[model samples]
Structures are given as C-alpha cells and as structure tokens.
Target chain A: MADETTPRLRIAVVGTGLIGGSILLRLHEAGNDVLGWDPQPAARAAAARRRVPFNDRLDVTLKGRDVVFLCGPLRALPESLTEVARLADDGCVITDVGSTKAEIADHAARLGLADRFIPGHPMAGTEKAGLDSAIGSLYDSAPWVLCPSSTDALPGFRLLTRLIIENFGARVVPMEPRAHDAVVALSSHIPHILAGALAGAAAGSAVKQAVLALAAGSFKDGTRVAGTPSSRTADMLISNRAAVVAQLDLVRAVLDGLVASLADADDAELLRRLQVGRGLREELLDRSMLPVTRSFDLARDDQAELDFLRRLGGDGGYVTGQETDATTVTYTALATR
Target chain B: MADETTPRLRIAVVGTGLIGGSILLRLHEAGNDVLGWDPQPAARAAAARRRVPFNDRLDVTLKGRDVVFLCGPLRALPESLTEVARLADDGCVITDVGSTKAEIADHAARLGLADRFIPGHPMAGTEKAGLDSAIGSLYDSAPWVLCPSSTDALPGFRLLTRLIIENFGARVVPMEPRAHDAVVALSSHIPHILAGALAGAAAGSAVKQAVLALAAGSFKDGTRVAGTPSSRTADMLISNRAAVVAQLDLVRAVLDGLVASLADADDAELLRRLQVGRGLREELLDRSMLPVTRSFDLARDDQAELDFLRRLGGDGGYVTGQETDATTVTYTALATR
Candidate 1:
C-alpha cells in the first residue's frame, strides 16, 4: 500500500467511534485519502458534522482502499469483517483496534483474511466513548500493539506498521495474539477490576465520606479506571477472562503474603513485601539510563521478519520509526534490568 | 490558649521535620509566637534558615507555651512526649502528629499526660521527608483528627481545635484513638499497600518495560504512593498492623470473588462487582449535593461536649470554624448515603 507505485495511501476506517474517528482524523490530517463508514446513522451524521469523509455505501468506503480498520464493538467485528471481505479490493489490507486479540485473530484466520488482517490494540483510551470523544492527537506517543502471526501477511503488516508510525505517531510493538491478550490482562484489565473492587469497598463502608475525603490522591488514582463505563470494562475483562483471572491470582498472592506479615506483626516480612515493587519502579523511572535502540533492515516480503518483530515486541521493544528505505525499522526498548 | 488573660497564642512545634516545620510555618505565618525545637541540628538549622524560631533548649521552647505539638518519629514519640511533659507549663495542652494513635495513646495514659494530651493525626503528606519538603499550605483544607478522650482535657482541646481551624485553616475532626486508627487503616494504609503490591507486580513482570510504558495514567495514579519512602510506609503499615490486616482480608476477598467470576465467565457477576465502586465514586464526586452543616454550642468546660464531638467525627463531620463567641463551632458533615 505504501509502495512507490501507490505513493498516496488510500485508508478507510469502518465504524467511526473514538478509536476509528481518531484514526480517520489522523490519516486525513496526514493527507491520506481517508473514508469513514458507520452502520449507525447517528455516528455517520456526527462524523459528517466533523467534516470527516463518511460514506453511506460500504462499496464506496472500501473501493480500492489500500487499508481498512474495523473499530466496531467486539461482538460486531465478525459481521463487519464479512461485509468488508465481500466489498474490499485485493490490495486493501485490513486491521482492527480491539482490546483482546486472540479470538478476533482466529476469526480472521477462518475467513482467510488472517494474512491481511492485523489485530491491533492501541494503548490509549478515556472513560468517555463515541466519535465526538475522538481527538486528532489520541495516539501521540502511545504504544499500539500489532499481532502479525501469518507469514503471508508480512508485506501488509510492514506497510500498516509504517503508516501507524508515520501518520498516527504511534509506536508499533508486534507480538503474538495470545501474548498480547495475556500482557494487557495484567496491564489494563486486572487494574480496572481491582479499581472497581477498591472503590466499592470504600463506598460500602460506614465511613464512606471520610474515606472518600481522605482519597484525594492514592485512593482516587487506584480506583480511577473504575469510572470507565461498566459494560465496556466488563466486555474487556470477560473476553480476556483466562489472562485476567490468572493475573488476579498473582496480585491476591502478593496481598495474601503482606496480610499475613501484618497479622503476624512481622516487621521484617512486611517491609520485604512492600519493597518488592519499589526497585523496579525506580529503575524504570531513572532517567540516567536511556532506552536501547536497534534497527532491523527487512526485505518487504521476508517471512523471517515476522519472527524478529514478535521477539522484539515480546521482549517489550517497540519500532521507533521506519527509516528512509521504509524497509529499515528502528526499535527502541528499555534497558534490560 | 484563647483565654482573655493571655489571648495571644503561644505555640511550640517540638520536631522540625516536614510535618513539624509545616505546622511551625503556618503558626508563625499567622503572626503567633511560634517556637520550634528538634534534637537534630540539621532540622533546627533548616527551620532557622527559614526564619522559623528554633530554640535549642527544650524548656525555653516550651516556656509558657499554650499548645505544644510533639512532631517526631512514631517510635520516638513517647520519649518526645515525656520531655514535653517535663518541660511544658500547666497551661500547655500537648498534642502530637502521628499516623497511628493506639500505642501512643496508651503511653500517654501511663505517663499521666492522657488528660492534657490530645492525640492528633493530620491527613496530609508527600513522598519526600525532611523540613526542605515542608510547605505552609500543607493543611490548608486537610482534616486534622483529634482523639480527645478525657473530660479534663476539654478546655485545652477546645483551644487547640479553634486555633487549628481559625489559624492553620484545617478542619478539626474529633474521634477516639482506636477509631481514628481503624478509619485510616482503611483509607490510607490499605491503599498504600495495594499500590506497592500492584506496582511491584507490574515492575516484577516479564513484560515490565512494555507494561510500564503503557502505564501513563490509571496505573501511574494507582501506584503513585508506592513511591513514598519505603521506611516511612513500612512504619505506618506495621503500627496500624491489625486494622490493615483486617482491611487487606476484605480486599483479598473482593479480588477473589472477581477472579472467580472471571474464571467462571460470569458476566453479570463481573459487571456487578465493577459497578460497586462506580456509583460511590460518582456520588462522592457529584457536587450537586452539598455537605450538611450544623452548629454546636459548647460550654467550654462541659464533659458532654466530648461525646458530641466524637459523634460528629465518627459520622465524618469536621469542625469548619469557630464562631466569634468561640464557644460555638460549625460542624460540616457529608450527607449520609
């Protein structure tokens, strides 16, 4: 899609909610021929009001488009993709902005779109929803996880990664679908779940007012994501049930040890438990040590590049930029502890 | 004391660390005769450098002081109180700024300072320590918990409460020592522990770098307090051991239920748990409902006023201000759910 033959990219975002709207706004601002389509007339009207190119017909939205992004609710993804599969041209590489990736990746595989459809999750969100909530700079410096499993998808994956990096200013981290699900469960889902529980406990207490008043900082932050719409949060959690449940077990184990140390009045044990998370945070935040950057020069169609990309992402490395040749991608990763 | 015989206040802050220095700064800035003392020369020097009156002699600092605040480490508090007890005048009502109150209250009881010593806990802090971190506005709108047990301390307690409200701009909350510890164990200590554990789990992960990079907002806030000096956090948790242990059990139970719901794929139960914390946070944050305000006219020396004050604080009420007559106080409490 980004080849010299087609210098001007043709990009379409299906379902213009916050994520899609953001993508459409970004691609359009970057001077790409971007089109948006949402089955909901209200969403279409809103996008039209924002001066986004919203087409009523799926044929027009997908016609000769180089890339199309599915940003509908998880439940509607398969049908949305089915519609795109019937209408989209062969050159159109499909991608998605979804939280959990394994099931969708499987669905793409069954539909013979796995080679072209890259499951992506952008690490940017707010408590609010809808196209009106979308902003042009939503993905600025945000890590966007892209799972490219099929070797046949190498060329499309490379082009999409380049566009996401260049147009959206998103750092692209490529990993396995299952791995992405597991990592995000710990990083996002479990925290949101804990937030709800913590907030609920405080609200349920007899001293709710005092507790809430005292929660000016830590408590408020700890339970901050509990404010996210419950339905959306529930969807993300339930879909990644295995990974989130496993992470919850880990946190509970840590909490159990601290609780025991407290109950036993063991000062040494308690201090030890509390300090476990400290060193890593300090090291992560220490500015003296800069992240290590490495570059990979890949042949556009090489299957081996997928393995290299997976290893880089699995180890928490992200592609910083596509070099002048576009085949050479720069990867930046935290200095290993 | 606010007595007509010696209306101008004479206050002493007996430790020149952050809390002590902040108190000294506030009182000194309010045009009071505020004296400061600390065994550590560095602290005293810092206070002196800031033009806060730091007398080397404890007796001189305590001389004719109407209120002396013993602001020292939790372990050193008893010794600090003993020295204040030895040097402070009969008119001096002694108080200490400590996190937990049970053990210190017990020591005060045995030292015969219980009647005159009003145990206080100010709900304000920063991760950093030392007088260099002191800010004059630390308690501007913060809650200052006062555990006033004995009837003999009523007159002194009244004076200190009025001074804290009118001069320091703090809302005085009156409660029992045991109750204050219990409430804070839930409000402060438990959240700190959770923050440390959550931050630790992320930092300790195999994907630590990726997780930390993605932790721009919610995770950052959730684990913010885990950055507090390990020693101070440890001391607070250990001292409030029993209550923290109990609260941890409650959190663990909630987490366990959420985990089970996730594992069982119980969407209804998961949604229920997540929404538990949402409603309370929404209600607490909604400004349409103003707090209920009431007036309490106390006969300065009445023993029954202690019970009234206790009820107010236990229900999360705080003294907003002292009326011009000084015998009447304004109590502002959150409207009950």
Candidate 2:
C-alpha cells in the first residue's frame, strides 16, 4: 500500500517514448519513484540512462504504483492500456497522453476499468519523436487536459490531476472525452491536415520550384507542421477520423461560400470576408499579448476560496496573490488546475 | 547629365512610401543623389526627416534625373505613371516597384513611354506599411525582378539592374512582363490570398472562438500574411485578377482531389497525399539549408568574361574568383546583370 502522508508517489510510466520518458524524468525529479516499461529495448535503455528504473515486464513495473501513465503512440495505447489494467494494483489510477481520448475512454469502459482510467492529453508537441527528444519540461505552461470516464472517477481524477499539476507544472483542465476530441479536432487536428494539404498542393503544382523559392514567413509558418513525420500525422487523423471529418466539413462549408463569392466575381464580398479574417487574427494576437484579470466576489474565509489558495501553493510550493477586499477577490487566472 | 565615372546617380522617387522611402534611404547612403515627390504631405515629411530631398513639384524632382522610380499603391500607379511621364526628362529610364508588371507595362506603352519603361518588383515586404516601416536593408538578398519593355532598351535595363544590385544589394532577375505577373501570381499573390482566405474561413466558422484559443504555430504561420491591410491585399488581387483567379483554380483543383479522397474514406490515399506533402516540405527546407553552387565554363581571355569581371568590380569595387585554365574559366553567377 502507498503511504498517504508523503507527497511523493510511485508513478509507473508505460512506453518509455517521448511523452513517457518526459513523464519519468519529470516525476522522478519531483521526488517520486518512477518505473518505466517499454517493449523496445532502445527505449528502456534510454530510460535507464536517465536513471529511471525500467522493466520490460508490466507486472513488475506496476507493483505498488500509485498511478500508471500510458504515453504510447495512438496505435499502441489500446494494448498498453489493456495490459496495465490487467496488472496494476488496486486503487492505482490510470491516465494517458494520447492525442485522441474518446476511443481510449471507450476501451477502458469496455474493460470495466472506467473508474480508474482518467484519459489525458497534453497540448504540446514539437515535430520530433522518440526518447532522444524527450524533455522534462515538455508539458510546462501547456494545457494538460483530463477526461474522466465518469463522475465516480472523481477521486482518482483529482489524484492524477494533482500529480500532473505539482510535478509537471502543467495547467490541468477537466473536459469530457468527446468534447476534448472535438475541440482538438477543430483547433489542432484539422490545422495539421490543412498544413499538410497546403504543402501537398504546392508540391503537386507545376510551379512547385517557384513556389518553394517565393515561400516567405506566411508560407513557412502555414506549412511548419507539414514537417511532422507522415506516420505520426496519419495516425492522428486516423484515430480521430470522425472528428477530423466533421471539422473538414465545416472548413468545406466556409470554402464553399468563398468559392461562390469568387465565381460571382464579387470583390466586395471577398474583401468583406478578408476583412473579417483580419479582425479575427488581430483579436487573437491582441488577446495573447494582453493579460487577463478576473474579479470574483468571494469571501476570503470561505472553504472553497481557501481550497483554491492551497492548490496554488501546492502547485509550485509557493504562490503569491493580491487580496482585493474583505469579501471579494481579483486575480489573474494563473494555475488553472 | 549624370557623370558616368562616378558611382553617384541623380534619381527621382515618386510616392515616398515604404518601398520608395527604403529605396531612397539605401541609395542615398551609397552616395547617390535622390529626390522624391509625393502627394501625401505626411509621406514627403517623413522623407524629409530621413534627409531625402523632396519637392511638391514633379518638375523639380524629375529635373535632369537619370532614373525615375514610381513607388505608389496599386490604385494610384496609373495616375502616378502619367504624371511622371509628363514631367520627367527624356531618357530618364523610367521604372516601377509595382507588384504587377503587365498592366503597368501596358499603361506605359499607351502613354508612348514604353521604350524607357523597365518595370521591376522586389519580392519582399512586411505586414507593416508606410514610411515608418521603411528600412534601408529591405531589399537586401531579395529577388528584384526587372521586366524591360523591349530589348532595344537593354542599356537602360542594365543601368537600373546595376542600381538595384549595387545600391540595394538585391539579386536582379530579368523576366518578361507577362511572365513576371504569372510567376508572382503563382508564388506570392496566391499565397497571400490563401492566407487571408484561411483566416477568413476560420472567422466565418461556428468555432471561431475555440479556434482562437487553440491556434498553434501552424495556424498562426498560415495566417500571418492575413493581418495585412484589407485594402492592400484587395488591391493586389484586383490588379492581378486574372492571374490570381487562375492560381485559385489550380488550388481548387488540388482541393477537389483531396476532398474526393476524404469522401471516399480512403485512408491510404489520404496518407499518401500527406506523405507527399511531408516529403515536399522536407525537400524545400533541405534545399534552403544547403548552399547552391553553380559553375560555368568560359575562356579566361574572352571579352564577355572581361566585361563580367568589370561589372562585378564596379558593383562593390572589388571582385575575386578561381581560374581553371588558360583556355577555360569558372566563376560564380554573382552578377547576373
């Protein structure tokens, strides 16, 4: 049984790849005992190099662990989850770093492990893969989403969330599995598709050479994600195929309006559409540059308010905030855990 | 009359804006005497602040000038060209830094100034505009294309090309007027349209707010050029409407193929297309990172070789190269002018 009083927890990291290795490296540094399991010998060797205990045997790795983090690629997650679910000790919480969460949640539910499986995804990645690219701070300042299978999993979800927040310094957001997939589909998955499609379109053109020469900041930025490995991008699209198709449908509808405007030679409508686009982009950039402050009417002595303050303190061991009033508070929404 | 031996040349720049102001600043620093004319008081005042001489009278600025550069917005170019032609001295070797060349070349031909007009475009710009955004090194290492009206104007073409090369440190490329328009439509014009359209499409979507929150590097890069002023982008597309439409058709065709592949649920085909895209992007990035070297076989004692050497020497006042043999020569394609 794990000790309840000590802050340090035992973390079993499955698939010692980029996300997994990063998790091991970070959790270990935070005074947690982390054991890793990867089928690949190279990955295990890499984990060993980082001084993270490695075992090819899933049964041995999950012994007395408080949490099991499945950080394998999209295709490997189901099998990895099945193995972890079968072997992990009772009361051990389960989570993952898969880009898609709906299918993983379904799989865990089918295995009668719904309460233990708190699906997760970190919205941070480079166009790199493998253990060599892993870094402890990969999740730093990035959104780390948690999608618990059911309300009954609240206790386990909170445990995993605290670990991610305190150890990884990641912003933990609670979201539904399907909603998470849909949101990411709109924000990230479709953008990746568009980037690749745009790059692909340029490649297949007769003026391909000239296009390459004239590509500036815009073209380079638009197509930056196209440099991601083909298998990785393909896997992401395939895993979330339904959500991706839905997002593509939305994009197609927008393009249809543009096509009609172009067909009619309606310069005014085209210009209007473009103007709206400029405004939206400006708003996004402005929001990112500007800090957002929120004012809430909360009694300082309230339990909920104190809980919020304690979580912030536990996140980085210390946090400072201003008290606006005896019965109200205003602060920047930092530590959105 | 301008002195042939001296590096200095008497130049007149119309519409003292970003492109024109940058040209004036760089050329003046290279010991050239430059005068400017702009209907906008603010533009002329900005030029004056930069110590670039300006006169409200077109006749005064154009007096005895060897070259007259038209650097106005797309909508203002025709009127600017007419006034420059009506006032500038004969054999002034009139040129422009307009994005589109065919229409301007046609306008100059109609005004009986075709023989002296050599249309040019520097394939470089920032999202920012006006004199404040002007920088002396705006054209450095940029592709400065020149489209002379006729071969009989070779002397004038060479002079303008040499000016762009030595004064601005630009790579001067000679192309036909229509060809320049068509190529730029493929390379720069259409990409700008896509950037704006992509951003516009996102804004028009139901998930606009979500997209704004979730936008990563790819979305931002793809939409960077969309932040450019609507009037400017609209002007560019309208000025080169036919070419822009043609390029749009090409893009639509590619999208059609992709949409069909997606509709069929052809994961393999979709992945194939994405793979091609990834490969193409890799090739582009690889080529950019690698330096290109070209070798030309020529006789060392040839007059053509000697003339090339002289131009290179006069360009920066010094030249160096490796000689292969007494009967053969090798040189870098530095001074294409």
Candidate 3:
C-alpha cells in the first residue's frame, strides 16, 4: 500500500547481477527508492547502462535506506553485511538473497547484526546473469523463502516479508535455515551438480559429438542450470557444504536403489518406478507448484479433448474404453460397424 | 531440385501425427499431390482441418500412388506396408518412417516387397504429437536416417532421398539397419526409459508431493519423454533390444565407476569423470551439433571471459587454464572449494 503523504521506502541492493538487479528493478517499478551496489566494475556499468539506479559508495548507499538487500554470492554476504552493519542506520532492515541461509545467519550473529538481519532467499533465477538479464517481473508468483533465526529481528523480518509480497508479488514462505538449505540442496544444488557431471561425462566420450548432435529440447532444458559460473557454484557448495553433502547422500541412495533394480532386471519394478516419477511430475505440473512451464503440448491435448466433449451434446456420451493419465491418453471411439 | 516440367509425384502418407504429419505437410507444401490415410476419424478430421489432403478410402489412397510413406506405430508398420503393397502400383517407391528399422526391414523382405521398400527413420520429434502439432519446418537441418538392404531399390531410394531433402530440408544419412537401431537406442529410447523410471521413483516416494513441487526445469525437461505411451516404448525396447541392452551396459559401467569413485571419496577420479562429462556437453554445444536454441545461459563463464577479451583490443583467445575440464570444474567448484 502506498501513502501519498509518506515518503517511499529507500532500499539498497548489493550485487547488481540477475537476482540483485531483478529485485532492484521490481522495487523501483513498485515505486520504492532503490539504489544498487556491485564490486565488479563491469557489472556496475552494465546496471547503470540498463538505467538501474546505483551509488558507487556503499556507505552513501546505506545511509538512511529503510532496507538493504544483500544480493551477492553466499560467501560474500557475511563480510558485506558486516560492512553494511557498521555503516547502516540502527533501525534499518537488512535482508539477503542468497541460495543458502544457515551459514549466512550464523555470520550475521557473529557480526552482531543478527537482530537487524532477515535472511531471505527467493526461489527464482534464469540461466543468464548480470543486469543485462534482469527483468522487473522475474520474481512474480515465485516463492520468496524467509529463513528466520531464533534471535531474528521481527520488525526487519516483517518489513522484508511485506516487500516480498507487496513489491515483488512473491509469496513469503518461512523455513528454518538448516531445513531450507537441506531442501534446496535436494531440489536445486544437487541437480545442477549432477547435470554438470552428466554433461561432463558425455563430453569426454567418443560418442560425445554425436550425442550432442542428437540432443533435443529435453537435454538443453535439463542442463540449463549447469551453465552457471563455476565460481558461484563453488561458493554455493562450499558455503552450504553439510547440507549439500547430505543431499548428495540422498541422491546416491536413490541412484543405488535404481541401480539395484536395473541389476535385478526387474522390469515390473522399473515400470513402477517410471510410472511413479511420471505421476509426481504431472501432479506438480497440474498444481503449478514447480517453477518451470508445463509443456504446451500437454495443455493443448487436454484442451482438445475438452473441446471434443463440448461438441458432443449434453445427452451424447461416447464410451471409448481408454485409460487416461499424465503419461498416456488413449481413445477408442465406438462406431457402428 | 525442382524442374517445372517434371511430372508431379502422387504420394500416400499413412498416418498423421508429429513425425508423419510433418512429412505430409512439408511434402504438400513442396507441390506434391499428397493423400493422407488414418483409421482414427479424429486424426483424419484434424488433418483435414489443417488442410492436409486426404482420401477416406484406404484402397483409393494407395492405388496408383507413386510412393507410399508409412508413418505410424513401429508394430503397425509391417501390416500397413503389406496392405499398401497389395493395393499400390507394382513398382511403387515405398518407405516407412519408424524409429527402429531392422525388424521392419525384415518384415518387408519376408513379405517380398524388399525391392519396393526403402526403410527410413527421421531422428526428430517434438514433445507434442497429432496432426495439429505438425510443423512444415519440423525436419529442417535434422537427420533422416535410411537403412538400405541388399535388394538395393536404388531408384526408389534416390527418389525418396530427393523428396526428403526437397520437402523437409533434412540431411539424408545412410546407415546399416543394425547401426541405425543401435545409435537411436543409445540416443533416444534409453533416455526415455530413464526419464520414466526416475519420474516413477519420485512419484512413489513419501515426499512425492513435495518432491514434485520442487521439480525444477531439469527434471521436467529430462522426463518430458516419459509421457509417451508405455506400449510404444516397450515396442521400441523389444525391437531394439540388443542395442538397448548394449547401451545400458555402457551406462551401467559409467554409473558403477561413478559410484566407486564416490564410495572411495577419490576426489581426483571423481573430478576426472566430472571433467569428462562437462567437456562432452561443452564441445557438443560449442560445435552447434545439438538442435538447441542458443541461450547465453549455456555459455561457459570461460567463454564469457574469452569474449570479454574483445574489450581489451586483443584477439579473442581460448583460455588453457589449469582446470579446463569438467572434473576440475566440479572438484574445484563443488567439493574442494
């Protein structure tokens, strides 16, 4: 909600890459006074070229800002927050947009800024990076995860939550720092790592060239996240080491079970596993819970069937005995022979 | 090449789905007199709605047709070809577009139509199917694989090759039937099976709902093919059983090596494997061997760094840094970092 008499809240955004720039752009579009800071000169120039407001001096940028959003590498957040804590107003809200939370929260406590910090991670990103890739609507309808520590500053958390909901049009999902790290480790980090690994393996083989030649839309989409900077991915794994390791263990366990099924040549079990996986994917797609777009093919086919039903009069029903599910849709039309 | 004086060929296309419909549409666009045949009334209606010329009478559709293209289920191809052989002109150029070739080739030989048939497969598909999903440019720049038998229908083969190139703009690749099956088994069938199995496993789990909710773009992309009919997949596996078994053995070996490396915590070997896979993907991507829409996200940071050299007024050069491979990328980035 905007009050004409009250001045707009000023927000400082560090790291003007995709995530940071996107957050800045959204806040700006929402009529908030937003300024950006980035250590990389190229990134800073890119942000400025894109008309994203920025201040070169971090101290000046932090001065009197109602909220400072740390949107950089997970490892960089601790020291950056420490620097801002020393310069920012006592009542200013501090939040982060990193992938992991436990370590950052710990660092906030160590920096004695825990009470003023609200650790938040938006579950949104594109394969591209930098301000050039930023879009104002990037976070719309995405989940903005808020990892609240036991000693978290309630007022800061509330303000950050409101910004996420009202300004970015994102739903606020509160999660424990460790739990959030673990869930993401399973859902995001490990997948990226595995994709990179799979791509690497395929790359090293004699068939590598042909494999790529044959690769269709699926492989490209599957490996999209693997294209991120190795440096950033490195920091992610290192900063969230324990949780990542834990997720890796889970992945290995799953893989091991799969390997066993293959070893036993249990076709029935294999088929069951396949059906279950397809079901899971469909359920998520139907619910719009996943961040990816469901294939238009699926939507079109569903609509086509619905259209067929509508064309048939209310009293006209065709019983073509066919089982329909996410993985398969069969139609057997009854006709007078 | 089109010659204005050349008599127009009468072509019969016996199916109208993603691959078949695409071939028919493209051929029709190239000025061939195309007649479509499908048992399903809805499929026939959809083809007609798309203005794909069709004859409802199968006998009329096949009679006097210069060439007949059987584009339907792998299992249905043999019977359909047999029926076409009985009705079509004695020396009609016949080709069937199915993923697997050896069995169909055998069927043709057994049916005494080997001289009239040129076994072929088009290595391209969209996630969508049906006549409405067809696109004229679907086969552009993709491989159209042909498996020529000893009977050597040279005239038919050449005519078919010219037609595919002229109409679909595909690169005709000639391979032995066995080789064609093997290559696709590794590249297509096995991947679909894996996707289905993975989807099933995840769906069957206690965390099924949550797991699906967090399924990122990768899982969705990786599992897109899982939605195809299980019977279709089973037929593929059975027809190409030997090749699929061989590829699975290779995959299993690789997976085993990875498991051992993980179990031993042999960082060097693990890094080596990771490098191999990454290099495979990058090399494929860089060469444009894959039919992927070029996205900046897939570009390696190293490539970005190389591109950045243009700003320094130096000739752009590839970096031969100490860690050029995927293993180095993974270990240095994920584990050791």
What TM-score does candidate 3 get on C-alpha atoms? Answer: 0.76
Tens-digit lDDT track of model 2 for B199-285: 776676654654564565667777777888887877787788777677667666666666566667787887787788788788667
2 or 3, greater by lDDT: 2
For model 2 the local lDDT of residue B123 reads 72
TM-score: model 1 vs. ground truth: 0.92
Relative to the real complex, the DockQ score for model 2 comes to: 0.30
Model 2: chain B TM-score relative to the native chain B = 0.82
Q: Per-residue alpha-carbon lDDT of model 3 for A1-337, expressed as tens digits?
A: 2433335778899788889999888877777788888888787678767877888888888899888888876767888888888899998888898888898888888877777888887877887878889999987766666655643354455456556767777655555577667656655666556555445545444454444545555456545555665556556655666766655555555555544554466656655555555565666566532121122133345554433322221111222223334543343322111
> Alpha-carbon error at B172 in model 3, in Å?
1.5
TM-score rank order: 1, 2, 3
Assess each model's interface with DockQ, reporting 2 decimals per model.
0.61, 0.30, 0.14
Deviation of model 3 at B37, angstroms: 1.8
lDDT per residue as tens, model 3, B38-119: 8778887897788989878889998888888889888788888888888888978899888888899999999887767989
Leading candidate by TM-score:
1
Q: Which candidate do you rate higher for lDDT, 1 or 2?
A: 1
- True-contact fraction in model 1 equals 0.58
Chain A TM-score, cand. 3? 0.79
Q: Which candidate should be chosen as best, given DockQ against the real structure?
A: 1
Which lDDT tens digits does candidate 2 get at residues A1-337? Answer: 1234345678898887788888877877777888888888787667667777788787999989889989888998998888888888988899999988899999999998888888888777766666777898998866677776655665576567667767777766556677667667766777677677667777877656555655656567767788888778778878887887877776656655655665577889878877876897897686432233445555333444334433332221112223344455544444421
